[model samples]
Target chain A: MTQNRTLSLSGERFTAVYHIVCKPAEAEARARDICVEQTIEFPEALVTDASIRDQIVGQVLSLQAVGEARFEARIGYPVEAAGRELTQLINVLFGNISIKPGVRLVGFELPESLARQYRGPRFGQAGLRALVDVHDRPLLCTAIKPMGLSPVALADLAYRLALGGIHLIKDDHGLSDQTFCRYEERVRRCAEAVERANRETGQRCLYLPNVTAPAGEIASRARLAKDAGAGGLLFCPGLAGFDAMRALADDDALALPILSHPAFQGTFCVHPDAGLSHGVLFGQLNRLAGADATIFPSWGGRFSFTQAECRDLVAGATRPMGELRTIFPVPGGGMRLDRVAELSDFYGRDCILLIGGDLHAHGPDLIESCRRFVAQAG
Target chain B: MTQNRTLSLSGERFTAVYHIVCKPAEAEARARDICVEQTIEFPEALVTDASIRDQIVGQVLSLQAVGEARFEARIGYPVEAAGRELTQLINVLFGNISIKPGVRLVGFELPESLARQYRGPRFGQAGLRALVDVHDRPLLCTAIKPMGLSPVALADLAYRLALGGIHLIKDDHGLSDQTFCRYEERVRRCAEAVERANRETGQRCLYLPNVTAPAGEIASRARLAKDAGAGGLLFCPGLAGFDAMRALADDDALALPILSHPAFQGTFCVHPDAGLSHGVLFGQLNRLAGADATIFPSWGGRFSFTQAECRDLVAGATRPMGELRTIFPVPGGGMRLDRVAELSDFYGRDCILLIGGDLHAHGPDLIESCRRFVAQAG
Candidate 1:
């Protein structure tokens, strides 16, 4: 597939592919408008010099009309224009154009220089597998549920899940620093409970607390979780900025495997021709932001993500991309224990199967349910 | 007129209203599911005690069928559930539920106790008006554009715009700390030029530099802009987290008014029945996060926002609320100088009219164009 056309630019440049749905007659004009909008956002006369036009302005590489009102426009931006920053790269990709309708960001072809700048996934699939000592099968994960539960109650649940051989136990994204369960107390108790369970069961079970908080408090909260002996961290990169997760992953003091949660990120992938492709938003972007495992609404779940989209996401996570490590695609949201075999076969061994509410449906025996979940995945 | 339905058993509870478009037969089930998904994401048996059910669980206040397959569901949560934090409040309102389709967050009825906790808009509409000394007329604002320009060129542009009596001069959200124009050098030079222009013209023209950066560097950049004598700050809250803006607003050291640039936020407001309402996402949320002025693509512009949606946004920004100050709705994106009269008449006096690329098209003289813009708004 000839996805991108080479632009004759002097310096390092990266290609950005967008799925534009507009009138076929207007496709060419719209493509030019995007190139101008993403760069100058001003009139043509503002380009005082030709070098600015050649170097700084985005160049349209290709424009192919796929459907009646659908065109795939590939534009190339100078690498220097991005300044090698993730936020700036995103701005260059779809910043102002996002406000305009009918433009959807589908894919990115980062130059080696630009792609290597981002330290993608500190502890990726292999590292996580090594950490949990679960190499031959899909990792079993679940959320410690019932938001109003006390720190003690949640810790007890974590302990039971750990003893039952779940590889990763994460906090429900709703579990923030609420009065009912303060962050520090909850982290300490949950970490201790998981450690106790690990000691008894002779297994490396990890407790990942949701550290999404006010920007200033996020680092401190992560530090506190680490000090409390928590194994990993779960972040809602959608609610908090994706860069926050990258910062935590890069932090030397609290170097733990990070899991990206898709809480408020649905808007990006929900629309067919507006925001971003499921593979790019849920898979590539999350991996680029240093998410060891990226969680999304699985197909046949409560959410509306399709099976094809989920397959694309898996491909995006494990695609060959320079030195960036492949991360785990944690399919979650309304996943059931009964579907464990099917999910494992579908996603293969390089995935994390997250089963939530259905774990409690088998009876009041949480431990037995979790064991059943682990066995089914195996 | 009555937007909220009071919950019978409530102590300082807040109401969250969602516009749900689902099958009439499934409206009740979907509403109940939302109440569960937003709060617990667990099964019913997880609610061990009645107190837990009453306090922790979200209660449906009212469900009114609006259309054949549309229903308005209002759910109430205890104010304490949010922990008096903006991030937590968002999580409580729509975290896990964002992935679910046919649900849109329309309105939030925050109690005084909850609303007052956020230091919303340090310099709100009145405060900004007082700062710029513009009364009985809409404020004139424009972005200093042509992204590849040098710092000196940008400073010259800022000087020309300030001399023309433009109230607010903001960096095009695309202008970040790039090699062409470093953040500190651009901010310092622009602040000096604006100050020099202000001194000569005897006008209070504020220069707001775009301080959107990596999570850790945001505060330092904000501090640099303030220390460089920049009058206010421009933040892309969509790219950076909203909490980052709130932290800057709440920072005692840098108390400058913030103007939020709607760069990557359009995804949430574009879809009608998926993400968020025009008023809630762009207006109420921006005010809550401490944007003294919020910028969005104006109606009939290059963007797809409608006039009615713009009106709703204005109302959401300026409407009476509990202690949260009213913010200015700065409408930009393809606004032409010729439409100043029509826009002014439609948006009324409480708006910041942003005229961008058109200012450059009128003539080579930017100052003269800005003067004409100011005169037209008047």
Candidate 2:
């Protein structure tokens, strides 16, 4: 309902702040005009205080003029508790109007509601540390990937890896419902095999399936895997939108810990200053987004991430913010089994050690092979 | 099956040219093992041939090592017809894998097959010149947003904005699936309104609507709108994935021009020489991704892009690479109407200028109000 105050008056954001740049000083009024047209669809007189406008959107922060023809304006919104989190939020902030030439948004100041709902990591530093019983040692992990494998084929590998004492065994990000491996079928078979193996060998290996699709299908999929005896869900918040993680966290019944994957999340970590700081974005935001453990490319991996950047990522994932404990940083891609100690020393016990291909290299007799690797490392 | 030769025995990506960083030497073997594991899951003997891998995945120039733990990969695939259309190949290269992580592709090198498909503006450079017949003068555009509007309400505003000769009118990205204006109903009504306005004023103002959604639904929605007489479709490839845009371009039946939005895409643009250079990402890559026009946060908008970054975007959108002309750069976010002339001069007339809130502030009579604002600027 604040739409009236927002539209007609100079004090409201519909008129207050914008990085308006033009030769004529009339740009402010023009900018104000734009605010009404974009936010309310009508002038002050047409809208009312109780209208949805007051609730759906609000002013974030505004700057007068920083550059040439540009102004920075941040609009605020209550955090979405349901579907399509990041996508919906981004659209609300700047969507169709983004195509207009000569306008830019240089910064954003998130409201506490949105910030709180982001949920960062479902299990922070202490939580993940408690899960694997590894304190002050890099957490060990790996992926069963290259897709195209049958459920039994992948399960055999998972069972072996679990027996080897690897802390986590994630399905490859590509393991969607391709003819090679149906999602539910694969998760079911693999979970059973791991359970059986763990019973015999007394090793704890968690299986995290990559669950990403449209908003509606996500929670159901998570529930399906959990019901099928799976340990956790690997959530691609970037692909599914960050808020999806929070929704999972919000569910008391479906309280499976989440392992956040960087799939399609390059935009957040790719840019330095323009998007979010490493600590704020991956650390604070991912935790807010409800990630229990978050994965990223590490230094000395197949991907070219510098030590400082990797370190920053580690710090972000493990930093304490408010009541949230912080997330575990899992670094993978081209990691070798032998260097576990080095990576562990670098990231301390608050990290998830991800070794993808190295685990696969121990082929044929999966149990014996993985047992040696795990014994040598973790 | 070159999987073995290319991924295993070859080691270090030596047979191919992508030099992703490797430390302790053994990491290269692990990465190769991953390629071997992911591609030819059954045996190490397969997946060795680059050609076989191409058959399944597509062709590519090379995957390189960008900064530490980051990679700069260049993949080149045919444009379905061409001789190095920079635009088409980028689509075929990583369109499938971008959804997965452990991929930090920071750079690209396009070939001719891809170069030809990057058709900028569709009505770009010269074609748009003939439409409004404004030679060397900048064009003005505006947005219709805030959702919750009835189809009738939306159409009325579209009618007025179109009659004002604003050149373009786009829906703000948030106008999707809410109770207010559903996709088909709103598109049909808005298109009719724009057409009616054209009949009255003899002016053609284009309406671009955001059509980003789940996988199968995307193509259906695009075709639906095109059938309903839509001029172009708006998509944030960042949200829907690049494949969605490629799907639109490849559809000969639904050959509507596409305007790419930068909603969740700002994260990628915020980096400096990190994820992807803006020229390569928004311009060349978007062109490759099949966007007729690419929208970025203009330097002076509510976003953080500096002036040099904005101008670079213009060059990225318009500059030529082989036969494919550059895409049109539609800079936007918190833009005002009064600065049209300045923006026009900076970006040239081939662009679509966008303004939002300013037009509504004109007066009570929406149509007359729209006319006065457009008149004042020109």
Query: What are the per-residue Cα lDDT tens digits for candidate 2 across B226-275?
Result: 87776678887766555457657657787677778776565454544334
lDDT of 2 by residue, A241-315 (tens): 565566676677877778877654544544322344445445555776678887777788655567887777766
Q: Chain A TM-score for each candidate, in the given order?
A: 0.96, 0.72
Q: What share of the true interface contacts does candidate 1 keep?
A: 0.59
Candidate with best lDDT = 1
Candidate 1 residue lDDT tens string, B1-378: 011122233466899999899888888888889888888788766555556667777888999997778899999988877885777788888887888878999888888888888989898999999999999999999988777777887888899999998999999888888866789999999999999999999999999999889888999998899989999999988888888899999998998999998887888888887788888888888888999998999888888898888988888898777888999999888899999999999988989999988888876888898889988999
Each model's iRMS = 8.9, 8.9
**Residue B250 accuracy (lDDT) in model 1:** 93
Per-prediction TM-score: 0.96, 0.60
The numbered model that scores best in TM-score is 1
Clash pairs, model 1 backbone: none
Which has the greatest DockQ?
A: 1
